[model samples]
Target: MDSRIKMENSMNMIFFGPVSSFMRIDAESLLHILTFTKKHLIPISRTILIWDLITDGKTAAFLYSREYLALGPLLNFVPEEDLYYVNFGDKSVLSFFANHNLGLHSRKYGILAASYRRYYGDMWYEDSDYINELGYLICGFPAHIISKITPAVFKKIDVEIFKKLSLCSVNQTKTLYNLATHKNAYGKPYKWSSHEITKLDILFICVPKESISSIRLEAIPAISKHIMEMIHQDKLEYFTKQQILRMNPEARRMYIIRVQLRTSLDTSQIAKQDANAIKKSVPLALIYVFTLILK
Candidate 1:
């Protein structure tokens, strides 16, 4: 599909589906598009940490158990925070470590192993021979490993990019790196209700853009109205029964209708008996659902 077409229809479009290879438009590109679209784009309040791309001793070991056993000690000394901001070419070295373990146990391990050999070359094993001269070399491991490795090894390894990126300044890089790090400055943590989570995935991840805005607005009111009406009409028990049956067909046949009615009656009776309860419940559900859909 043409990316531009998707962008034009919806300000929010995932370039790649989740669990697949993808490249998203960066924040700067997003801001420019929003400006041109002139649509009141709902801002993403939470920062998205691509933890899948972060590599350290713990992550490395998790992906490639044996290979990580061999290289884990060295990677453990590399400061994770430092690599967060640096641009290490088209494919960052950090991603290499993060993705390495993934390949170790992969069905295509040979392909990945060959790729790593070609990329890093034999320079990686040079540490074994220069152990004394490069005591500092072991320091190239993950941050957790820094304390374990010799100080001299740490000194010899070139970590200039790591140091520069950690300080929050790099030539022409601007501060875009804030998206991955800088918690308070960029993204906040969002606690979503189950319904809200479902809405977000459908609107942002599944559906096309032209339909999202309309579907989102309609879904909130439709769901709220259905819930409220069911409660007032004492049909909640029947609805609940139907939902249960839909979820589990092996439930006892004798209590099926009775159980459903009981659940529906509970909700319906509450709405009929308590005006304040109905007012309070529906709005909260609507708001929760709306926030996620709009996200």
Candidate 2:
């Protein structure tokens, strides 16, 4: 048989057909299989495959791929060492973390940050070699480490690397954003231009309550829709009160009418079933939300 045919048959037996046909596999063997398969590792619900990936510490990085990002919530409960090898540089991987609230103060976020820091050191050149400090920016160093890096080494780094940090606090994001924009403004002024605002992406979570207009009309589409909506909502929110007040009386009247129409439409968008659920719970809990309304 031809080489392609042999490879296809092997894949079929390994994944599509009964995976149990193979001899009993452990985490180390699974890592070997994954590195050989590379992108060919299909995203399947095979319990044994997921089990091996989560049970072992070193196998985590070897299992790195877009397919496994969906396991964020499940990984939250697994041994931290199991996630020590996760690739934090990828936007998709970060999205997986952001959607799951893996940020500063999250107990689960430590291993991920530590992994990135440790891997950066491991990937560094020895004393005899040229230290490609700039080259390491692509590794997506954690925000804490980024803050601690020496200025000489840090200046060699690009602003884009700061935008890519795994998790950042509000102050950290604000400081980085200022450096990125050269604003250096104290207390994070909200007056930056629209172009600069769009670059925040996941970092925008740091200022979730700010006026949506500061963000671009189109949210960062590369990540999950849940994340994109938070950014895009700014475009969807009504214009600021100052802008409305600045309009001529006639224009202001028209704007008020438009706002009322929008309010009506937004009201209509609410699911009737949700209201019905609320109604059913009101009798039991005096109209409090999910906690007082839990099923």
Candidate 3:
């Protein structure tokens, strides 16, 4: 906040040595500089320096893939009238975006995360690599099939399914799930085919039922994968926590449906006397319909 400190931060460029010297410096002044810094005057290295210096991730995320980074955050330096240009497609920039937490409020976060998955096939979850994959699968696949997949299940899924799930559209994933679901309906394990089985199919056969559903739908897979890990460890009670309960409403609804299905199924395994409890837990009308169909 001091004048000299602000000028010192502004003149950071003049201290031409290893970045280590300034890396620990507070970046508030540098963030101030970002306000008046012209498109051409923007120094890539200094920006990276600010990214490293700033402990709070939101501010750090604004430095690279500049345009996409600017959309969500309110920065004093970046004038809305001025068009900031940066190539988001570059591999290095993509990697940078992939690593940082850009605060979930950004609308473009889902698309950028998908692009990151496309360029690098790192699996965010054991079964699916990107959140978008889970979203598409939830919108397209049958919930019954999704519930059956456990880590111990020895189903061989295609290697390319991960990439396809992350990149494919809703209709594409839906069509693929339909193919696999139709085959599975015939009372046998559907043979997995890389050509015939799509990423959505693999996701249905892998992601936890509790994790499907999203307002955007493309981002559910990421949330699912995160929740899937907790589920695997028998941490079913984790969802009762406030943070988990406060997730996107659509996702919460989908998860609640999953829990209801599980509860209904479990009740069916008990004696006739327990049937009354199931009716109290799930809406009777919905339970009756699922019973007639799912049974």
Candidate 4:
């Protein structure tokens, strides 16, 4: 480590840039700087994207993780590919990534890659975005991993992603249901709302019997047209037949009736189109048959 770099008074203003330039002149100096760098002195808000410069991302990440991790989300500086070199086996490292406000555009890219790379346990997430990312995954993520994801993600999650993920265990789904309808932003318990229950999309399939019993039967239709539009898409994301059977009787009945009505409308339109095609085909068929007989 060089004595010239020891000036700590200007770390926030002059640290990373001069250090970067000096590192280029003598690459070994960068490692020394990273080794001796004070964890608290690094400025988190500045827009410098120095993370890509480290050829040895793993060693560099291990040494300077405290200072540079927020750079990943803040600058989108560390791509998921770069993070592959850095080990996140430490729970604090992984948790730090979640607790930070996300700057990564997609939930699947860096966040998903981090969780997917690890085995389940010590798993939990503070950012609601992680839940949004996990919901859309094409492959299996451990159901238990959902134990800690912010339930707020469910309210804003793309209904399509919500539909694709019906992988919760009964207890996990119940937990999501509990937190979503009966909890506040701080994860404190709140009174559950039957109307709020309708907003959970595919999670509606696994509603606990107690919740179903609580839903106001007459009010089910009043859950709002916009909300229904989100839930009752033409494409099925979750298997509704058996999966939905366990839903509260009132909610289940409403879901079935809506689905049946949608199917009936679709079938009737197709039937009319087929009837018109049959009328046009009859004349062609007769002429073809007559030609065949004459031949």
TM-score of each: 0.17, 0.37, 0.27, 0.31
Say what the RMSD of model 2 is: 12.5
lDDT of 1 by residue, 48-115 (tens): 12222333223322333332333332332333443233222224343443333321222222233233
| Model 4 ranges with Cα > 4 A deviation | 1-49, 52-65, 68-75, 107-115, 121-295
Candidate 2 residues 1-295, lDDT tens each? 6998998777667656666664356655554554456332454455345546544424565554443544434444555566676665664554454344322244456566566555446433222121232222323334444344343443344334435544544555554444443333212424444333334444444443454334332322222233333333333233344433343455444434443343342344455448665455333322211221132
lDDT of 2 at 118: 59
Comparing candidate 1 with candidate 2, which one achieves the higher lDDT?
2
Top of the candidates by TM-score = 2
List the candidate numbers ranked by lDDT, top first.
4, 2, 3, 1
In order, candidate lDDTs are 0.31, 0.43, 0.40, 0.44
In candidate 2, what residue range of length 10 has the lowest lDDT sum? 284-293
Off by over 4 Å in 3: 1-84, 99-101, 104-189, 193-202, 205-295
Best candidate according to lDDT: 4
Q: After superposition, how far is residue 152 of candidate 2 from its true place, in Å?
A: 12
Worst 10 residues of 4 by lDDT: 185-194
Error of 4 at 5 (Å): 24
**Could you tell me the TM-score of candidate 1?**
0.17
- Alpha carbon deviation, residue 54, candidate 2 (Å): 6.8
